[model samples]
Target: MSLVKESREELNLIPQVMHSLINACVGMFASAYHQAENKKQNLLRTDILTEQFKRLLLRHIRTHKSTSDYAESLNISPAYLNEAVKLTTGFTVGFWIQQATITEAKRLLYTTDTTVKEIAYLLGFTDHAYFSRYFSNAAGHSPTEFRLTHRK
Candidate 1:
């Protein structure tokens, strides 16, 4: 039957039947709407999470050696957090971590006469050669070449 016929099936159909259905639907909709509002009030944005990730990363760069360890401290899978970091901040988690590492590398290069090998270990590279390669790729100059050219 058509919806109109179905609703009128009791044969006493008039304003009362229409009123009951409208009220029922409105009640359920109101309950769902309020639940959604409450959820919105309770949750933080992904951007806030990204900011927290940056702060934790800076702390780790100062004190630790690994992104894997940092992600563990934040209680999230590194891969999942990396994806969120990319989406919200327009940079991979690795990208920021690498930037922080490279920044420190640059600081030590310019401000101190520390050997590149020493700076590499201080920044947590397992091998001096690998640090040289990684630093060259990131800064577009070998660590020594960069220091020679850029230092004041």
Candidate 2:
């Protein structure tokens, strides 16, 4: 009789225990899914910021040459801007700025009849000599040399 009573109690507890385990597993899965969603949202936000930064840099590259200027415009810290840009593009803000400047300088040198000094001034350089040095360092040739080689 006692054995029969104990068996009945054990049988009643089994379904409750199983239900508790199922609830626990469902909770864990839900938590994990939310976390993954949050991570995806964060990544999307960072990507948007990076794209905006690039656009701002291109638009204002001649007038604003520093990362801090873009950062200020975006209302973010310079360090955060650099980190996001680097994470998305595998390069720093300064690298992109230098590349843009050099590419524009090369374009001006190759296409127009603008003198090197005038080109330098147009690109916001205060001194043409420093611009020539900067162009040579990034482009592997001075502005005049590049023009002579690339021009017909």
Per-residue accuracy of model 2 over 36-136 as CA lDDT, tens digit each = 99887777666988999989978987887888999999999999999999999999999999999998998898889999999999999999999999999
Model 2 worst lDDT window (10 residues): 39-48
On the 0 to 100 scale, the lDDT of residue 78 in model 2 is 95
Per-residue lDDT tens digits for candidate 1, residues 1-152, read 69878777766666688999999999999999999999867765566668778888777785555557666887878787777788897988878888998999999999999999999988888799999999999999999999899874
Task: Name model 2 segments beyond 4 Å from true.
Answer: 1-43
TM-score leader: 2
